[model samples]
Target: MSADRETLEVYNARAGDYAQTMGRDPAAMASLRAFVARLPKGGRVLDLGCGPGSWARAMLEMGFEVEATDASDAMVAEASKVEGLAVRKAVFEDIDDVARFDGIWANFSLLHAPRAAMPDHLARLYRALKPGGVLHVGLKEGTGERRDRLGRFYTYYTVAELTGLLADLDMVTDDLREGADKGLDGEVAGWFTLTARKIVPDTEARTDTA
Candidate 1:
């Protein structure tokens, strides 16, 4: 079955429990910190599908202006409880702001979007970023989709597939890696992480396009 509103609602109902178990994976933390280090000082960052605001909190603590959004109301509420955080309750498809963010951290979130929906989602992310903005995406690397016992849908990606998608939008990848990490289940999980920068036109091209 396709993941719909009800599926998300179910996930939200368990948000607290999920937070307790997978609050912040250590590997995820390291990846995010590295992504932040490459960004300009005090840059505006958006945490797409930010669950419980862990990464958002980290970025805010680092002095970046961080804004977050999640499709689950329960997750949003939980994220808001974190001090000094702006958490929006909205789906990725609802995001419409353009050229406003310097960086976007979509850690382990876009996997919920089906393969067909990813291109449009990526386009929206590209539009939301300023010229030369960066985007960091994390996903489980595999062949198909599945839902774990917790009922959240996940889609995996191969490095080549992901790179091709980003390239189609003219984004230059700064980093990409695959590795194993502990999963919400008790087993090790394989995943891929990618960081890419929005390619901007040079002065001559910008002037002409303008």
Candidate 2:
């Protein structure tokens, strides 16, 4: 799914400030490390909507083959500044490869897409991963879509709503975490991160459902 223009513009203009505001805490660092440990050494990973490439850079430093992507030009530029990082400009819909990545990091990125488009975008992401590949997503917790004070669009989802969506696509939820935090707009919002794995097929029925 394409990113909302105003939201994209906000990120592009504040890429630096955004980067400065984001740094992994002890808990976050542990989560990242846990995710890395789940993957094969040097496995291919896609950092979807990688704003400033912080997570992508961390993964690359850990010796993974990383590809970072964002829809904003400035975000892409910032990501490119990282030595040895391979970043590109593209929307979520641009992910067309099948079973290519061993992991997909879509943290807080897909929230910009319209609620109605979430299923299709997720389906695309699911298709991009190899069987048994891992997917991690972070999203604000709420019931509807709205524009934040910063003029950036957001689509919120309840845990049950999101869990159902993933279940429909045959993704098995593995880990879940929830809390509140201040974002670029200085608002404390509740959010949740879910890590899921694409189930390896045991029969033709599994592949046909997706």
State which candidate has the highest TM-score: 2
**Could you give candidate 1's per-residue lDDT for residues 1-210 as a string of tens digits?**
123565586657877876776545676777787899878899999999887787888899999999999888788888898898888878878878899999999988898888889999899999999888899999888888777665667787898888899999999996776788776545677998989999777984678688
Best by lDDT: 2
Worst 10 residues of 2 by lDDT: 22-31
Off by over 4 Å in 1: 1-3, 204-210
Cα RMSD for predicted model 1: 3.0
Across residues 70-128, which tens digit of lDDT does each residue of candidate 2 receive? 99999899999989999989998888989999999888898999989889988998999
* Residue 38, model 1, lDDT: 75
Q: Where does the lowest 10-residue lDDT sum fall in candidate 1?
A: 1-10
Q: CA lDDT, every prediction?
A: 0.83, 0.87
Q: What TM-score would every model get versus the actual structure?
A: 0.90, 0.93
